[model samples]
Target: LFKPVGLGYASMVIVFFCNTYYIMVLAWGFYYLIKSFSSTLPWSDCDNEWNTPSCIEIFRHQDCKNASFANVTVGDRNMTLLNISSGLDEPGHMNWELMLCLMAVWVLVYFCVWKGVKSTGKIVYFTATFPYVVLIILLVRGVTLPGAYDGIMYYIKPDWSKLEEVWIDAGTQIFFSYAIGLGALTALGSYNRFNNDCYKDAFVLALINSGTSFFAGFVVFSILGFMAAEQGVDISQVAESGPGLAFIAYPKAVSLMPVAPLWAALFFFMLLLLGLDSQFVGVEGFVTGILDLFPSRYYHRYKREIAVAICCLLCFIIDLSMVTQGGMYVFQLFDYYSASGMTLLWQAFWECIVVAWVYGADRFMDDVARMIGYRPFPWMKWCWSFITPCVCLGIFLFHLVNYKPLTYNNVYVYPWWGEVIGWCLALSSMLCIPVSLLYKLFRGAAPVHHAPTPDLQTPRRGPADPRAPPPTTEAAHFVRG
Candidate 1:
């Protein structure tokens, strides 16, 4: 839809749309945190409606007059648990209060990252590290529960029959977790000093990310085990994924623990921090990309705070759809379609092709060597030129062959038009490369040139020229040549 306008604008639109969803998710974490404090056991029962018999029974002894639980009705019967639905959909109304919370989150994010790296960098020291502390706390508590071992066993014990599926899922998870094709990493790295050892940084970050994922599995399963034991159900019965895991099952488990309110608050607060960290980087990338497109003089004078505000405002307005009664439906659509495996694989494949073929891998290595004072191993070049592209292409083709229609809660099948819209969303990111290339070709644009360094411009004295005069200075060489 944005093709005719320009690639830069299209990129901005994509970034804005994606960031709005991040904002919505961050708001969700805050909503749960606020709810955690209002009630001693907010997730004791899925149904929050005070008029309901279950709600009355659950809260009769406690102060049941709290306004937070007053008018909330159980909605959307797709993922029913304990006689309550996901509360994501309510036939024909918008969740105006949730919308307000979402707006508030956008405002918070604006201030957190408005100063760009200077502010966000400091914030990351906490936002990034605090999750581990919370996770460890939860892990300790989880393992101490009666049936926590069962949950951990269930999590680690693999089914050999599902090996192929496991490999595919693992690859997809790693790619997304590392934010490979989202352009955030690239934008963040651009701020680093030219001679920084990005090679070392990449490995360290990857290890940290993968390690956290591993540790989190133990924490999640241990709590899930406890839930299963308490309910007299199998671990499989209590296990859930995505929003079901975060918003429903996990909260339910936390409410059963001692000092439930405190645990819930800590857990939800950790979630909020993690979401904020992700949003900080995403918004930073969006702002950086826009500034790079505009004049450098304007960027210097106006700086990023104004751009940050405008982006936040626009994203807040766009994200209102998610706060509606059908907002979760829209959120699911965006989640399944945008930043999907297919799109990421497509982007990765093209990135490999561009750097390894079009831009010349050998030349890239030369630049890297100049910056880092040592050349990368030959294996990296081979991976860039061949292995990475092949793997990406293979995974992408595999996904196509095994494509399934999008669904919600494994029950609500999206309509044909909804699936079409999803395909369009997936294609939006994939088409940027080819569409922009075609546009440039049609406009007769020339490839960008990188001027040679002064050292490179000066010719080295050769053994064949032993009788020749001393090598000329760089300035004299440039003047003469």
Candidate 2:
């Protein structure tokens, strides 16, 4: 079996690669948030230098006289600003606005997590709650707009035939939402006290996350309905997906609203908070994995602060390529390969195998019982041992078999060399497993042999016992999985 150190190292690799580009998204959010304060949003019309003659303004308000609201001429300017370069081959110079935003984002992330949970924990009080406030406000405003009912209905209406094509996408969304195989969840979990009722916490977190997602759908679709109505197009035509939806369609939708800048500012502020919340957590997870490798190394004053600074600086330098004129292509490549569903499922499958089959699921249940003071239902044991790993492996293989080249708005497929680079990004993280295994094997590490099944017969150990593990926040003995 791979040691905890090896697993932790692998987790760090995943987080580092994922976070590097992931935070670039936050930089975009910062740019939009700053831009939203203007009387005329940059994307609200075709007047900007970045816009082409073909650019069409979709804002339907009487105040917007650039073109008839519904007359979309011959052009769609959804991502024109972000995708100024023709393609990945023509990576133009750095976008100083976005570059500065990226630097600011990295700086903010560093300060938030430099002190670890002490500072981040406090910040979550605002970051975690503020999005919901904005979403609520948006939902209320959205439902009042003309054609809002159409949008909400379109959002809630089931499309059965699409399931065959999109079920895998849905699964991937679930993984991303919960941060399933990411070390951030595990790193955050490590801080819990031994008897802190994590089982309950897990259920609550799942509910909240899923519920928020469902609720946000209303906020989004309602606005999309308004956009479609303004453009005299079906909701599907105006319901742009991905960054186009967030950066273009949604901004234009808000610009037509009363107090346009106010609503736009709130929307982008919520986006910034959401991205920062995720960003700092991912950074913290990587930092924790590194610090744990040599706990003694952090004994010096401000060592953690220095470590976080270095991490942000290195990642910022590496990510500078993504803030260039062709940065969107690079960003999409990283998002597709580095944090793809395939990589996530691969990690999750192995994690389940190690915990359930290798270490024994019944024994794990016993450990949980020891921590939470009762045995969970037996079905959860079956899930850990059989159900989850099989599902992960099945989906992993399915994705591999059906893999497609990355594209931009389904128009520009990445070149063969670009695809090769994407696969390399993917393999960089997945290779950690075999690399760790080979290292252990070369060192002549013995395969672990499990003892008899745990029947809750052993008494808990105390801090005074030399054999006991370190104490938890609640003073209970540490229980290693």
Candidate 3:
């Protein structure tokens, strides 16, 4: 919608809202860590008597505390994990303390990136690397636990029956994990010097990213295995994804380990650092996009620090909704719909088409050669032209055919209207490309020629190159053409 002026601000606004939930969840982790210091272990405080007769009959456990079974109804209709109520509900209530922590995170993010890349660059040196240190420490500790091997095995073991779902999940994860549909990669690349070897960097970073993800799986599942052992339940019973894994399951596990407070603090702090790095990059992408579109004069007059602050403030305000009692529902909705794989697939397909077809693959290669002193291999061109688009299109079609309604914890299926709203969110980014193409086609009265200019003739060795070129009609025609 803001294409006439620039798409930078629009990109920033979209990213801001999308990442706000990440910030909120990170804050929730912090809240749990801090709360752990004062209260009894989150798992150990369950009531002696079962609140529901069904729960008593099913599990036959004296108390709900320290149990792997999460569906046991405790008080009212609420289910308990480690005696903590699973606050997974529609229009769920707000958490004031967590809201305050989220605001603090916003403030911290603003201060960290307010000065722009210089500040963020330095911050990333620590934020980016510190998580690995913590992860290693946790991994070392996690593997030492009795049931850790079981957890690791479960994480790596493939269920052949679920191969189709696995492929879909893997594809979606690869796309997001590499940060591909989001313009963050593009925005980050824009900062590189013209001569930077982007092709080389791409492979290195991709490998490192994939490796980190693989490493994290062991750390996470190993810990969950220990938790399952402690609770005397199956690893599958204790396993959860997303917020449940970070806030409820992991924290409960940490509470069981020796030096619980220290480990809990370190774990949450690692989460904070990891989340901060992502937020920093996200904000940088937004800011860089705007600055790239606008002239330097305008940027100088407005000031980047102020621009960043405004972005942060707007994000903070908008995210307040997600911090409300019912905010998890809102957050889940955003996660389910916004920046979804379908939207990403659509974006990637069109981007490949544009660069490989509309923009001309040969021209793109020439441009790359000019910048990096060597062109990418021929296979890359083929990949861009055919393989990429076909894969993206195939995945998108497959997803549409196997479309599943959004659900929370296998309950609370989104209403059809809600699903429609989700589709709108997903399509918002995908629609921009076709809309812009149509707008350009209809708005223009004349076709624009985009043929490359021919290389200029070298000047005569001695001097007076103009005189030499003026002699021949062919030369003149070539020069003019």
Per-model TM-score on C-alpha atoms: 0.83, 0.90, 0.83
Query: TM-score for model 1?
Result: 0.83
Using lDDT, give the best candidate's number. 2
Model 2 per-residue lDDT tens digits across residues 1-481: 2343255556677789878999877888788888877888777777777776667655454444334334342125332456357789988888898999998889888888887775677777788888999999999999999989999999999899897558888887788788887888777767656556778777887898899889999999998898766666677766766776777678777777778888888888898998888887799888877777776844878777877888899999989989888888898899899888988898888888888877678877887887778888889988898899899998888888988889976678899999999999888878888787677668876543333224323455312433344334321211111
lDDT of each: 0.68, 0.76, 0.66
Cα RMSD (Å) per model? 9.2, 4.4, 9.3
Error of 1 at 384 (Å): 0.4
lDDT by residue for model 1 over 1-481, one digit each (tens)?
A: 1223233344444555578776777777887788778655645654554224434222222433433332121122322222223334443455666777787888888888776676666667778888989999989888998889999999999989999888877777677788776776666666655555677667777888788889989998898787666655566655666766777677767766778888888888988998887787788878878787777656455577788889888878768777665676677778777867777777778777767775578877887776566898989999999999999999889988998888766767777877887778777766776777677668876532233334433444123533433232321221111
lDDT for 290 in candidate 2 is 72
Q: What range of 10 consecutive residues in model 2 has the weakest lDDT sum?
A: 472-481
What does candidate 3 score on TM?
0.83
Best by TM-score: 2
Candidates 2 and 3 compared: the better one by lDDT is: 2
lDDT (10s digit) by residue, model 3, range 378-460: 99899999999999999989988998988756655667777777778776666666565566568862321233122212221
